[model samples]
Target: MGHRFELHKDVELAATPEQVWEAIATGPGIDSWFMGRSEIEPGEGGRTRLTMAGHVEEATITAWEPGKRFADRTEPGPDGTFTAMEYLIEGRDQGGAVLRLVQSGVLGDNWETEYEAMKVGWDMYLGTLAAYLAHFPGRTAAPVSAFRPGAGGPDAVWAAVTRAFGLAGPVAEGQSVRLAVDGLPPIEGVVDLAGLPTYVGVRTADGLYRFLYSGAERGDALVLGHHLFADDQDPARAERAWQEWVTALPIG
Candidate 1:
């Protein structure tokens, strides 16, 4: 049986509606905060494509109202399961803007785990969005991503990640962290999101780094989603360094 679900989140950003709209509706805007690389065709009925680790998924834009609203839906699968996402942006009288997100979808079998993970995932991504607007406004990031396969479930993966990064117990927002992966340049930053068993985010002066635990049910273990804002950073080199570092982790 398929399970239907809807998740809603509202966040106030320190940016204008135009800025918020650009972040949510444009390709470069999404690449800076969300998972993978994205390309969006303008206006309603157009296509939105996201590519990650050589895999691609596309959705059709269902609604498009510049600076106000944008929505997209993926085609239903064989079991009639599909995902739809909508973003509503409203400019606030005091200056910034309020961004609301509604994500509705139907999930096949393992719905509970998937739904729970999705909930956490959105919260993390939205936080990244907020960070992007507040600190790195008007800049497009060079995205960096890598996956650690065959890592055990969430608990084991979280343990290993924290252990590697020297994080003890549950990390809190505002906590300072230093990442010293052997193959990559050292990263020193502050923790921005820390939802145990699901996500950990670190924000450095030049980047937003995300560590995600994909549940065991999905057959994938951990994912590193990072965005570098420094003009001299090479995304390809950074990605390779991360990939090598993750693949060498003592897991499973």
Candidate 2:
């Protein structure tokens, strides 16, 4: 065998072991967090394929214990390297569970280099999965900084903003709507806030908007603030324009 490399990671999920297991066992559930299409057969000798962005990795289940433990031996890659991946779900006294991922196998000459990169990538991806699972059914969208009465009602506010900064174009049914602003590049998306079912075009790159809508406030108000933007833009101008745009909207 060639030189071997092992990688292990653990994440404490705020979900029951069953919930975690469900997430791991089901295709949709696994896709939601693992960034792939995973097919997991439920018993020993089962196999799996984790496909992400068109890349696929094959694994064979060597062990399975329902909602508790799952292990697999991955097929070696072209470089003659492979991994034995395993997961252990331990129920905690507090009604949650701790999920640990362990990977051990053979590696080529640069094990340390690859290991370091894997460490960082796993930390970020697993952290994201944990957070997303914790906030299941929640939408992640643009942040909201302030909302105040405008000259017109919410409808008017919507119109003015849309008129000033029209939709980048019609988005696909399930895709996000991009907004076009003058002198600034288009923003990625607008999300529905609270009971507001329709997507609201809110700029979130400038940092002018610090707070996000959590479905709490009411009234036809012009919601505005620093939206997120590219660093190349003048921060002060972006903030000022964002504030001014909110004020210019018509309130009821």
Off by over 4 Å in 1: none
Residues 144-178 of candidate 1 have per-residue lDDT tens digits of: 99998667877778777877777797778988888
Query: Estimated TM-score per prediction?
Result: 0.93, 0.53
- Positional deviation of residue 85's Cα in model 2 after best superposition, in angstroms: 0.9
Worst 10 residues of 2 by lDDT: 207-216
lDDT digits (tens) for residues 75-120 of candidate 2: 7778888888788999999777998998788876767655764665
Alpha carbon deviation, residue 14, candidate 1 (Å): 1.1
User: Candidate 2 lDDT (Cα, whole model)?
Assistant: 0.55
Report the Cα lDDT for residue 223, model 2. Answer: 40
Residue 101 of model 2, lDDT score = 92
